[model samples]
Target: MTSPPQPAAGPVSPLNSPLEPESNRKLAMLLLAIVLYIGVLLLPTPAGLTPAGQVALGLLVLVVTLWISECVSPANSAVILTGAAVLGLMGKSLTPGARPMKSADALAAMLGGFSSTAVLLVAAALFLAVALKHTGLDRRVALLVMSRVGISPARLTLGAMIVGLVLALFIPSATARVGAVIPIMIGITAALGLPINSSLGATLMIVTAQACSIFNMGFKTGAAQNLISLDFMQKAFGRTVTWSEWFLTALPFTASMSVVLFLASLFLLRPQVPPAAEAEAKLRAQLAELGPLSGAEKRLIAVAVLLLVMWSTEGVLHPFDTTTTTQIGIALLLMPRIGVMHWSQAEKLVPWGTVVLFAASISLGTLLSKTGAAGWLAQQTLGQIGLSALPVVMVVGALSLFSIVLHLGFASATGLASTLIPIFIAFAQTLPVTKETAFGIVMIQSFVVSFGFILPTNAPQNMLCYATGAIRTKEFAKIGLVVTVAGLLLIMLLSATVWPMMGVL
Candidate 1:
């Protein structure tokens, strides 16, 4: 009656049966992330270490822990990590002559990120994204491009990439670009008479994400996070990156990578055939009935262009700095009560969590450097590797890969960059790679971190496409791997030759 020695008859089963293959895979990844984190601790170099090392090690630990827990959402993880780091500082881990945590001081430090120019820009970008959605400006623009390039699925994918890149200049957030482009992509699939679930659409989404991340380098306001990286470079290495100079150096590489990404997508995304001529005609008629750009759309477009002109001609007009651009742009849109979207509407459009993440990540980066964690990390990890240009390149590549793989578990691109770029700077200095190589690699990471195709969470855009079931997991894997490899190679080539010539490194 005692359960007859249940499970003793054979090898006892786990209380929770051994994980399924997928579960086991996840478990392995979690374990691997932990192991890599510990490796960060053991690394040592010639430069004697300090409190900075401890902070960097702590950050690595925090990232792995968040990955394991699936904690307070992806963006929130940044807030938590930053908060923890600041608390640790107050606990004598960061500051010497340590005193009890001051509520006023901690509050100021934590709030500093929210008050940063970058966060405001992202908030404004998100608001504009909402306005774009309400007025259907993005859809109209994307569909028009599709109509012109509808001859082939490959061409359509390229067109989507172009549109995303163009938008990247106006919309600083990857999330905003993805949100804007996703509906238009779906509309294109439906209009082409192709299966809504075709791999082609998924591929197109990936292209948009990657291209958006890559081409963002061409414009100062393209990615708010890039400014963080630039700030670190300047503060750490005494380098100044002018908007025009950065654009000049980054454009060729971004352009080259875009072309390569287009080809890679074409090879990977095999599309289903288009619908019958009559069906296509009927769909076109329905789309036409929706009518041309509404007055609201025109107004939104004008505001967007006005914002762009300000960002682009900042040197000429010099009205407000990049930071003020966000506040100004949002005010212009929100004040005018632009079309259907009122000031209240802007509230919903902005991802406050993301803004918080931006703040938190910047705060974290600042702490790492201020606490000397970054320098310690550089000494420990890269110090022993031997100073050589090749070794530095290897370090950059390794860091890029590390950030990218971590992206699988992260839902926010800014969050991923915020967590990893500080660690990267720590290690980058130890390498013999030129300044340009280091900068380019770090920039490339903004693109690589969003590159995976394995799951919907890899990027917001991918998730949107996945919702349509247009992409099989296997298809995403194949396309993602190819694009990822192409991106790395392009980064390497540019770092080796192009960036150096531009007087960057």
Candidate 2:
């Protein structure tokens, strides 16, 4: 039977008609952001406006394009931005030698992002996720989770979130994390006699929120974009975001956010009591279905632990670090003897588009820095915006907010980070805050880029989780709003007081 047509919100104006309202909004937003970007570029600068302004303008254009189509593919958008930069330089709009836009050099420069430990680590982690899935290890674990954890509705939701977060440390990709876990979550929730829609909805939203948030803090290779942001900060400012330091800086926020999320889940998904017999039977069924761990699972666990040990003690463990761990894992993945991931399967597993997007975005950021575009814009805009510390704080906050909003349009975190970090770095140049503070804010923004409460295209993981229908739009909004605000505040406190006391300032 055909489903009834949904009711319209209001009489649709030409601008609001369903035929292309969203696309039109996206077009308008893209154009407006581009216009604002040009304004930022034209603002008076010490060097008579640098190429960084044009670079920033190009990024704004990309962001707009992404918001509209939600299908341009972030990597392609990055490539286009690079092309625009070259054209601008060629046409003298960005100044001669403003950026290395030659195809050969830009291609080479963009590829450098792949060499980072962060990228390799994530690739390793993806292999690990695939291995677990292929071997049925994840199902076994999920079964154990449902049986060992209580069947109470509230506990189940929390359990699912925890599972998703833990998996992310090893899984790397949000899509994989949710894709692997949501089906299992739905099965377990249904077995417990809970409403699939509301329970699953809230749980999945929490999963997306927690996965992105914790990964932002947990490992060096937690997320691809985290590495991109780190690379930009270190290359531009000569700083290293050590795993220990990253964890320490993000620990308080992570813990606070996790707890807040748990409470938020409870409130949003009010768990009514289920029939005791039915719940126990469902739990028993799930547990009974689980079998012994397979060879692949055993092998993967051993390899994963080895990788973790190496990550935790990179300095002392035979000079291995995140990159080495990833390389080793990938090598194992390609080995026929391992039988974990064949070359063909492994090739499919790597998110090559994401890798390309990172490389291109970084190249763009680098181009801005080289052309003196970033510094010029920083001097022009920050000088007029405010000369005081408080104003700088507000600017950082606003940038963070802009990044989050841009998430609705940009599908990838690295895309947003690479596009914005250079501009932020430039702006911070005029402020009194240390480079670390500015970069730290940028790092925080990268994490927040995974936020997507309303639309499916916000992030890959968000879309994957949303497809499960476990979380509703309103429910996501309620929890996401709280997390977003709290997360921003946590960063503000850390940047303003904690980091200052630690001499990061």
Candidate 3:
């Protein structure tokens, strides 16, 4: 495909550079955070909130502000927020007349998230992703699919997307899926001699990132945020969300959105040049290089299929929980003789930052709900916006829009879920819908939180693709805006029609 025009060379003057002011900007963000903290603390406590809840709210504001401005990395922000939560609870306990929050209680409140089953599941899933990468199976599958689809650019893109959807079934994490796919797509660009700035290169990269995020919604384990939401639902309302239920509810939207993403990429980021006839031959040669599947590949494939079957049938089979199944799968992958990956290699590939972020977010979300902050804020905000007066469908649409817009201010989907899901659960209580209907609405909001297409920082996958420099921020924004709008409309349409029919609303 034809490449975009290269930027003209310019002097490397640091002071006059556009990014030169970032340090000052971060400093300003810190200052703004301090001011916001003070402002929230100074305001009279909202009705129905305890002192602890108000303190939590202040901390939430500071954390959200710092995260949006990126005064620090998201992992660091999560750590800082965790510390704030601890100190806030401790400070409340120190007050003479206040109920005593014991040191053990405070510690449990902050550290509990680290011990979550969801966190453990993510850790195990990362091992699977690492095995796929180390064994080169991910690339083999990509090339095999491309070879079968031939060399047409549109067909290649479609084939890549289909491969992504299939991977989502077994690979739980979107970040992991992106890691597996990007290098293979990059190699394709190199094989085709496409310029880094070529339309085809950018399209392939953007498509891979976008498709990963879209398919993440289709399965229960598609994203860590999904698990977090399910956990919250169980704790808040004693509701259990099964794999089949999640699949049936989310698959329709995910499938439709995937089509929308494919069409959008095809039209908005179509290759500028047609593929050369030799492209198919090159892909076949690459696939041929892999030769036959090794025993390791066969073993990993067997274990992955077993894990998928277990996850899909967990509710009916009455076997082990999803977390246990994952743990068992990890054990099989690490078996001495049959293992496809070594611990040292898998350890290196494990995303510790994501683990920490997930744990901290879970801790923060638990605190927000337990402290009554989520409920208080939900009530006040909804009342202020007259949300309680609107029809349930309108409220759902409003929340869908709010969820999408709020994502712009947060870099991590799990972080956004931790912040918004609790508030949504509380807000749902204020609606006129039945408890089941309210839960369905909350679930919809939770799904929307993963729709992080509007900004590169909205998802790690987006950031990974953007790091290649093939896709500019404006270029991403152009497609992101359209996809986001389409997504919002789809959520509304489902909420009004499909959800009610499915008894979700």
The candidate that wins on TM-score is 3
List model 2 lDDT by residue over 1-505, tens digit each: 9999998787768766676866776566556655654555455644565554555455556555553455455666666665555544443433455554465554454455556655555556667777777767776666666566776656676677667656766766666666777777666656656676755445645555555545555555667677777776777778666655666666666777777777776776675545556766776776676656667677777777777676666665456556666678767755776756676766675667766666666666776676666666556654565644565456656666766676666666666676667766666655666666666655655556544544545667776766776666676667777767777776666667775666554
Per-residue lDDT tens digits of candidate 1, residues 1-505?
5555554456545645664655666566555545555465556623554444464556657665665445446575666566555554453433544554454565465566665556666677777777776777766676666556554667677788778876776666666677767777776666666666666666766666667656666676677666666655565667545455566766886787778777777766755446435434644664696698787877777877777776666666775666677577667766654544787766866777767766777776777676666666655654655543454455556666666677777765565666667766666655556665666556555445545444556666566656666666776667667666776776667666776576554
Residue lDDT tens for model 3, 361-384:
888788778778888888777658
lDDT over C-alpha atoms for residue 504 of model 3: 88
Better of 1 and 2 by TM-score: 2
Off by over 4 Å in 2: 1-47, 51-56, 82-86, 91-121, 199-211, 276-284, 287-290, 316-318, 380-383, 391-402, 405-411, 433-457, 496-505
Write down the lDDT that model 1 would get. 0.64
Which segments of model 1 are wrong by more than 4 Å?
A: 1-56, 67-69, 91-103, 191-193, 199-213, 216-218, 237-244, 275-283, 316-319, 337-340, 387-402, 405-410, 429-456
Best candidate (score: lDDT) = 3
**Global lDDT of each candidate:** 0.64, 0.63, 0.82
Screening candidate 2 with a backbone cut-off below 3 angstroms (N, C-alpha, C), the clashing residue pairs are: 52-373, 200-470, 201-470, 201-471
Alpha-carbon deviation at 272 in model 3, angstroms: 3.9
Minimum summed lDDT over a 10-residue window in model 3 is located at 89-98
RMSD of each: 6.7, 6.5, 6.4
Worst 10 residues of 2 by lDDT: 86-95
What TM-score, over all chains together, does every model reach? 0.79, 0.81, 0.90
